[model samples]
Target: MSTVPKREEVAKEFQWELEHIFESEKAWDQEYDQVKALIPQLAAFQGKLSSAAEVNKCFELEDTLSISLERLYVYANMRLHQNMANTKYQALSEKARKINVSASEALSFITPEILALTNDELDALINNEQLKKYRHSLEEMKRSKAHILTQAEEALMAQVSNISSSPNNIFSMLNNADMKFPKVKNEKGVEVELTHGTYIQFLESKNREVRQEAFKAVYATYGSLKNTLGATFSANVNKNLFYAKARKYDSVLDMYLYGDNVPTSVYTNLIDTIHENLPLMYRYMELRKKLLGVDELHMYDLFAPLVDEFDMNITYDQAKSIVEESLQPLGEQYLSVLKEGLNSGWIDVYENEGKRSGAYSWGAYGTHPYVLLNHNDNLNSMFTLTHEMGHALHSYHSDEAQNYRDAQYPIFLAEVASTLNEALLMDYLLKKSTDPKEKLYLLTYYADQFRTTVFRQTMFAEFEKIVHERTEQGESLTPEDLSSIYYDLNVLYYGKGVKVDEDIAMEWARIPHFYTSFYVYKYATGFSAATSFSKQILDEGEPAVERYLGFLKSGGSDYPIEILKRAGVDMSSPEPIQQAMSVFEDLISQMEELVK
Candidate 1:
């Protein structure tokens, strides 16, 4: 029986060393209490940020308190993620959550108070020696002056922040811990528990029946709870709309883009550009259907292997070495840091019962970043290793290079470093592949990333756009309405080359990214940007490597677009996406030629 292991069954070396965050639960509690105590100190400056001296003191205090609070929160929640059903860590996380809420409510007045000052006054404060370091953060607040509410209103908004997160919390609890799927039959004719982690694994099966069974089985479970999910998803969108309008943004998308200073055109243009070239997807799907020998390529066939009986089962240690080898173009210091993090307790490397599905690299500023991965040994897992370590290294570099206030990079730029890693890995692997079959498989894999990361995510971005816009216009959504929007998008993106399964309609209900408004578009944009950067690094060598490394270490020192602009990819223009599509075309053409 292939069963998932318990958390305790995982070896010490394989698990992350979260003790780096908090030494003990008792230590976590002590810091939690300490954070509570400092909340009052932060509140003490609520009305006193008018002077540069006062603003400096208050901002410094806020940074100190904020750092501690973040550490506490990150540690608690990460512990909970190790095993979500464990109530002991659940209570620990909730306690951290409450303090974070209290801290926000207590310190919420700072931004509004700063915005209340006249421009001349703010510039004078910025000119002050003590406040010079916070210029970027301060200027960002000034940029958002139009949206800053009254201090009282801001405090109320802070209070509401905790409540606003209820939809995500509810959805997560239900999805990760509460919801259950029936046992699914694998390619070997053995039954395995259908889980969020295993769903993708099953879909990659060469056996069509196994893939279809897993796909239908997974979505059927989601479809059964369509009403509840519909309500939950709708409520989340409504929550976004509520906050956007309250902050006086024209739309929820504006509110999201506002923080990173990313123009709405970037989001819309990504979708439009991809739409213009979706025939590329049709060609790929057409190829996929022929390759798989299926009459119609169904949703489950999305990840089916192009080459038969080609196994790239890379073990964890081998993945580490391969990832390290792949990143050689990045120079030595980068490799040294990566190697240390890879070997150290910086990663939680395997799937266990109740652990969160999917993978992410996350940490608070004062510590090294941590990655949560449900790593199944395969080619995809090797790519994931490179991808996530890309994130970890970005965090590691940012923290090392920037101050506490500036170390936190915005979400818009987060995927760039990670996807660039994947790009480099693909380049390394493709160049090093001597076998025709291996090279073909590698080419298809890269092609699929374009399909999934760029095209599929844009399809998702469009679904979010339509649903959120409709709801913003005061229309309500039901299960059927949500499903219809998603289904239509799949058809449009996939074209007539593939069968758009009805179960795919329920697909929207399972994506956790939907809960995070306007976030998925970055994956597409970032992939494009990273692809562009990889070309530069490969072609130009040392100079390009320096610029790219500078980008990684920049943290949140500048706006995401400006940072990328300095690094050579202008995301504001549609050229990067167009270029990325051109590369996608090359891959598809290569596949066609190789197959022939």
Candidate 2:
């Protein structure tokens, strides 16, 4: 209810020990220097990449350089995120970016050079015992041989990587640094600062007036800059279109999906399935209107708690314990590592002034993964803890099982572990509660996951696909165009029950994910896959647990779909998604029954 604490006020143990990556600033600088020196050495192996020994040598150099470069970049970026106003970390972050660009420029020739080899030459080279370890990595490169341009062109692309990211950088600057929201009165009738953190809290306020005021205030700021935001977003779409065109891909969607071997069907399937289940969302919205006793449910009214009297206040320590208990089916091996990370300062557990908003699990190879959190001591924050831990454990297992070169998992498979943890936690909580009101609250929260993560993300994916296709077709997407499309999607997705507010049309201007097209759909599919797998783990027990663990350990060793298949969820088929929807339906039905 009050302001978030400053970073210094948080106790020592609550913060992550970034020193695990490097002892001090000097040590970080030493690694930074090593990365700068090592990157240029890739030039020596550029033209001489034909031989098996030469190819193997390039991989070895790249492996070491990449590991060092990632650590330096992540360390700097994490420091900057902790306190965005810090000029020292800001410079270090920029320095890391320069090193990254240098590394990309130096290594640009490796792909084209590898593509230059004849099929026979490449096959024989990968067949060698010394080069066998890199076969999967090389094969992946070879798969993109058709898109691999000349060495000169590749170098040009790499050199301009930073320039290409200007739109996202501008958006971040405008959204986080420059933008300010008007102060709004909370439920207590006290004027409070509206922020990215406080905005969500206000939306969850029991007072509808506070929720509506905060929502309108935040959007008003974003709406004022719609043209500028739209221009930046349009530039990003054009940037993706440029790369897709240059690569001779069918569309920007194809180019983005190509990297992970994902088919366009997956994106389409998610949107289609969600649309088919629109009535369920409509039913939920109707229930929201009834519970809030509002004549018409505005967009802001959707976030107010249905069971206002049932506060599931949970502390960080309790969240960790709940996560441990909920994840018991995952076995002791998983729990031990999770507990160690929690106790060993692998988590920055509370929000503070100048700290990054939201949460994520991130780390570079050769270091354990870390979690960033803005703990609000609420039910949502508790669930977020388990969700991020899912990602942390996934990284931990992958790093342990695979070499540095192979440990990095793709984003497609990344959400499964996190969402699965949420599902397990939900099940654990539901089973533990016998109180009808408590059960209704828990079920409502679980059902909201489907609406927010699955359906809303699918809406975003649809919007992204349409905008990119229009961009590719030489259509200039203006602010009006963006808003009109978003509003139409809102109408379709929200159905007739909920009023599609006009100001909500400008919501597109504030979504940072739009800068990266086709990325949000993974949240939908990942949630669906996790839901299906969580049910399997609960129903089938050990076998399901083993398979899911194997998928986590598999990491980037295989394509995302194949890894999921081994884990007993075939995302390629629509069954998992349908099953996830069934879970949503069941939750809604259960909630309705309990409310009656």
Candidate 3:
């Protein structure tokens, strides 16, 4: 058995390398002082920005200051996130955040003021030799001229950024820090706490009773706080509505789809398509019910292992090789970067007490992308490794290829790279495994991916759309209202086969995405896009590989859907979603064959 160190011991053992950021804390402090001194200078360019020289000077100075401030902000926040209980780091992080916000407010007038200038004036400035350096930035600013608010309004928005983020912050605190769950007994008579972090593990438990009990216990806690959660959800919906109105958007949906240059049809289409596919999902549930030999399958039994649990245990070293081999289709340049990342400590690869739960890849421009994972040496963790590395490699390529302004891709396309990596890894494993049970497990696992990504996320998207539309129509949602809407959707998708418990009605309270305003739909869209891309890569080989790699390298230089289109996936069409559902159908057929 692996050693379980004390919480304090784990915190002491986990230290991130900040040398890439600054030589020392003293140096970071010095930089912070420099940023503070520069903030006032930024405020001096408030109104007089008509001249080309002035505009050019402002852009150069602001870019330098913003990049420096971001480095400090990212480093400090990452340090604090690494260990939330550390008061010193927490204080330092808060200070950095405030400093960055102040800097943003100080520089806020540049865009709006620039936007206020007539097209002729902007053209004159752009034509000037000095401002020529920022031609792309100027052009991009002009693209959003219609949406740019006045200088005063922009300043107001910047000042309120922290307050605007409060809903997500409160949700995080409630879900991760404050919430508690009852101890649940497994089939082996082992007691496990049903915390948010451990809930997934319990769902995957072999014992049906354990999974059901854990799900009930966890959702029951969420159900109790339904009122508070409703308020939080309302606050978030209001925030989105506020921004959409302020930006002159027809609706919040328009504002969200505006950023990605996609139409509302894309969102509605996923919902419509998935609604049509509900019977397929129900069929899968029926199969699961029969396989488990249960009278009824509860929502908890959704994640139970389909076969005897196989320990596809892999060491960190083995994981690296597996990911590299699986991703070989992307070519040597990609593999070389992965190798560098493995050697350069870009990954914090193990679970420890007090470390932030979950896996994610994060970094600032001009730094190596870093991945944080709670590696458990199982197939799930192995897939997570590849998934996060896909994000890191995407960031690496983008940061190398695009300018700082365009390097950060939107959330719409972010999942494409990550999920594509997962699809690739699944294909690799399925081909390598010949054992019937192992193959059955792998196929079932892939089917679950479809269920979670496509079915569950679409269900969430529909829930969000309904809640937002109701709020837009001047209706208020009580906790009961939210529960009823969520529960009905669950019944629609799960059908009459599975037992939809009353506690499952309150599941909406526990989901963080309800606060993100139509964000979950991307997971469904992304999976569809990934499925299409993965198939092309496997079928067409090198040419398709080139396009796929280029997609990763493109970043935010263009719209995400357009970028994927260039890479060989047309998300505008419903074909990809249909293809993903077909993959699910094939999996069901295989599982049926295996069970027979």
Candidate 4:
């Protein structure tokens, strides 16, 4: 039997491929020096951007500088992520970050200067042959021009960017570097220290007492820091409020939604729809309680494995095959790119000591989008593989289809492609599974996805809205205040079926996402849209597949909502969310039958 390798050993197995971004570290440093030297030239165009030709030339130069700088920055950061404890790489990465900030500050005046142009002048510039190449960029500038502050005010805002981002930075330092949990005995009677990395293993422990202890101990740590977390969250809310007020927006929500060209109704609709379907979620909890044979379902019992006697350990190779087969519906082009990404050095597969926890897909222009995963041999990791591959393929398609100016997609639609992969993978597994226990596990997992992606995220969205509104009205939130609000929301969602333990109230402190203003709602909305899109692809076949691929390739050429509509998902209506909830209802019914 093969045992799990130690984290340090794992890092040694896979050296990162920085050659994808730069030929060598020495070459990267040379380019970094060149970029630093070019910084002064950026200021030359700062005040001279009023002329149409000069503005066009300024944007072209800025884009070139941005591209080069991003390549260096991403390469350095990716190297640091591989082994964050390496002091050499860490210093280089920090230098890169500071360089990025300085470059951004230097180029900050470009937007305000363009905003200085009168509407007619901006239009003429857009129509001019010299500037027409940047029509999309110019149009976007014009759209946001109304909200652009005076040059001095814009400079003030730029100066505060570091301070404004401080809440998230503080949360990061505390959570990743300082947070600690109590050791608890596992099913094997082994005392394990509960760090962020080991909490999942403990949560999945088959032993009930072990799971409960781990859950309580983990949240207890968060609970201790609840006041500090609350203040940090309040600071983020104030940051959003400051920008919204400065920009003459109606509300923080309005300001956030405006960036994606979406409306406040979309956010509220998700909350309202999830609330209407609370009974379905409660049914899931009731079923979990019955199946687990527990008198009371504690918060820790939430992630307990439903199926025993099924050891479905998939190797990394096997997981790749499963993802490829599941995503084959998107056509050969999509499949081909995915296959290359997996086979090529596009993924940093598995974790190491000091490496970043969790997974993400990242790359700059002119590079294959690379994914970082802490792969374990399990069904969950398999799904994670497909989910991140979805992101990589989305990036691949967008880069292929659009110029750098319009290549980047918004965060609003980022999860749609990723979760759609999950939907597809879940469907594939369910159809292939034969054993009742295996089927039950898969179904339970799918139900949990709904609980998390839809119900929980909407709850978070509602919490964010309320917190922002309270702050806007001049009410300060203490840690106890946040805990109370969070606890009430949990009780409201879970109903009377599951016990909402006091420690669960400290969940707000543990969610790193709370530091991001009004962002959690996208997870809920994206899952809903994916549900609708996946169903259409499986049911409608070729046309739906074409449109979905088109959606992936659309990038920032259109507003996110409009792009979704072009792909056959009308998020403006509640139908897609309702459809997703109905799928949840069906899964609950299936799980109920299988358990019996």
CA lDDT, every prediction?
0.89, 0.89, 0.84, 0.86
**Among all windows of ten consecutive residues in candidate 1, which has the lowest summed lDDT?**
37-46
- Candidate 2 residues lying further than 4 Å off, grouped into runs, are 1-44, 69-108, 151-202, 209-239, 348-359, 372-377, 470-481
In model 2, the clashing pairs are: none
Greater TM-score among 3 and 4 belongs to 4
Clashes in predicted model 3: 0
Candidate 2 lands at a TM-score of: 0.85
**Candidate 3 lDDT for residue 380:** 87
Candidate 3 runs further than 4 Å off? 1-40, 74-99, 119-202, 213-247, 350-358, 474-481
* Candidate with maximal TM-score: 4
Please give the ranking of all candidate structures by TM-score, highest first, separated by commas. 4, 2, 3, 1
- Model 1: which residue pairs collide? none
Per-residue lDDT tens digits of candidate 1, residues 1-596? 65999999999999999999988889887887787777887757777889888898988888898899889889989999999999999998998888889888888778877888998888788778888889898888888888878778988998999999999999999899999999988888988899998888888887889999999998999998899888899889989999998999999988988888999888888888899998899999988987888788888898888886568888999999989998999999899999999998999999999998899899998899999898888998988888899999999999999999888888888888998999889988988988889889899878988998999899999998999899888898889999998999999999998889898989999999999888899889989999988888888988989999999989999999998889888888888898889889988998888877
- Residue-level lDDT for 153 in candidate 4: 90
TM-score of 4: 0.87
Tens-digit lDDT track for model 3 on 303-406?
A: 88777777688887788898889988877877899888776767776665566889888888888888887778788888998999889999999989887777
* Candidate 4 lDDT tens digits, 360-413: 999988888999998899887898889998898898989889878888999899
lDDT, residue 12, candidate 2: 94
What TM-score does each of the candidates earn?
0.83, 0.85, 0.85, 0.87
Q: How far is 210's C-alpha from truth in model 1 (Å)?
A: 4.5
